[model samples]
Target: MLQNKSMIVKLLALLTIPVSHATGQVPIDPNPFWQSGEAGVYSTGMIWRDCNNDGYIDVFFSNGNDMALASNTIYISQYGSLLGTASWYSANAEYSGHCGVGDIDDDGFPDFAVANYLGTGGFSTAGLSNLYFNSNGLPNTTPDWYTGDSIYSFSCALGDVDGDGDLDLAFTTGEGYTTKKQRDLIYFNVNGALQTVPGWQSTMFTEGMDVTWGDVDNDGDLDLAFCYDDVAAAV
Candidate 1:
């Protein structure tokens, strides 16, 4: 009876053991540094930079949903550890989508932009975007500027398209169940501020999803490429 009991106990222990450990294979840790615990609910956009000028790379992520009963938050990292949340400049808008970082004000420090895909009510069509300037590599709660009215922004990109030595802004806009065909836009940097380039808005294709600047044709000047979400045949 004692021998039979020992055999049953050993079988139970072996069943509890994981297959990887039993097979002598080491399991890899996905979140080895505990960075994922800091991610807030509905976290979408993430970017890495020296946000505090500490020479160590930091991370930033936009938590958009209201799942935690809290407002939209931007979580920052401090040398591989989750530091804290940054004060969002726009209190009323929900930033649960794409984000980009660049120096929009010709400052030495980099600035960041967040896109408000869904508005406060969670299905609002009046989406918005905000540009927060950096003060000595730290984000300023007060935004340097914001988008105009009736603009439903989705994604943003920063580049010197005109090659004038200052960073410019390009963004995509559209929403669900809307008849208005979405298009991309470019705001040229002029004297540390963004100005909508004349006739630029009319050149975008339908259903603009994202925009980026590059010299695709090997030209000296940078060209803009807009990606669309739908396929349209040339009729």
Candidate 2:
């Protein structure tokens, strides 16, 4: 958590330019991509975290697959400047699908988790997805996928569902076509590994797309917020 870390990031420098009267109030230039109809970057999920514990928020983007030349990237500053980036397929089959981030281990530092969907939307296959935990915030090594289904959607939310002090993860898969249609699941941390809570799959949270973790009830323990429907309806 690095509670004492500085929140203000020190900028290097800013240069000033003399203004010439091109016009009274210079007309704003329309966004080139918007005006020219150029295709923009497509991202599925992202998270804000101080990866270095330096107080600067780093951006982690996910593309959900290994296709698309530049599907996954990490940026530090604005205007598409690259800080560090990596390819997802550079990891084990245990982790090669959807990706996300959160304080999964409750060590105060944020960890990275990737859901290895294996480029498929089915759930019958085994060893399909996993989560890699970065106890430290470095991105040099491949991520670990130690939880959830690999063939279907590998989404996660962080919270303490059973009143434990440590944060736990809620996972889901099945993709809505399973015989039970019960992809919703909760993994309560036992010592370290994520162990599924009994009856978690029986929860009523079906047909959800995005799951956000927060203290909705303000009970000190984190709560859950689910955004249902598909991409268009979500937007």
Candidate 3:
């Protein structure tokens, strides 16, 4: 059966050559702020959490430099369906950098926090970067400027560092200057206003790219784990 052996060899060879076929799975393009693959558009950040407890990753997408169309567009989706989509702050403006999430107001529900770069399409224009407190699950109202605001919000984390049962927020901002020049702004909730928490600050990080919070140290106090891109070599 020489002919049969040749046919089997041919089939084996065909199988060896990597065949590429589409998975027929359409990826959910949930980021409404930036069109797919458009230049000068930033899409996602380091902050990703299971907001709906669905066991699926809820990805939040935003813009970096292109503020005109990027502002006010944050989409949250899982299972290929968009569960939440809202534009909160800096309407029709460009939002840059990263965002955070946790129950800052201590309602046992997670709240949302974002760090706006406060610049133009490039780093030329500078304005006040903002932090919005989402009291309810998602925004039911329009995203006007809130009462407590911060400028140059590069990154943020949510935790009750003081062990007060009420979760607080820790955010960082500033230029890529000295280590001390970079600052940590701790917002403690008191009577609905985010008052400052004192003495907990140190030279935690420089040029903080993203901030995450959890009980990493196992000390029962919620700790901060920040990704610092600029000083990775130093660490």
Candidate 3 TM-score, true structure as reference: 0.58
* Alpha carbon lDDT of each predicted model: 0.57, 0.46, 0.48
Clashing pairs in 2: 1-108, 128-150, 129-150, 130-145, 131-144, 131-145, 131-146, 132-144, 132-145
| 1-235: candidate 1 lDDT, tens digit per residue | 0111111000001133344756774444333333244333455556767666677755555555322212334444555455334423334346345577777776667787776555555544555576778877677765566666445555677888788888888777655335346566777788778764422563544655566677878878777766555643211
The residue-by-residue lDDT of candidate 2 on 1-235, one tens digit each, is 0122222111222224444487543334323221111122234445666655656776655443322222344444333332333322233323133456666666766666554432433244433434456565555345454543433443556666777565566654434434323355566766555653433653453444455567766777666665443322121
Best prediction by lDDT: 1
Candidate 1 RMSD computed on C-alpha atoms after optimal superposition onto the true structure: 12.1
lDDT of 1 at 31: 31
Clash tally for model 2: 9
| Candidate with the larger lDDT of 1 and 2 | 1
Indicate the residue-level lDDT of 61 in model 2: 52
lDDT tens digits, residue span 1-235, model 3: 0111111000001123343456643333333432222233454344455544455544444456323325434344546344333323334455555666665555544555556655553444434444454555453333323324334455666667777666666766544533323555666665444563433554654565566677866879777666554665221
Ten contiguous residues with the weakest lDDT in model 2? 32-41
TM-score of 1: 0.71
Provide the clashing-pair count of each candidate structure.
Answer: 0, 9, 3
List the RMSD of every prediction in angstroms. Answer: 12.1, 10.2, 13.3
Top-TM-score candidate index: 1
Q: Which pairs clash (backbone N, Cα, C closer than 3 Å) in model 3?
A: 67-93, 67-94, 72-87
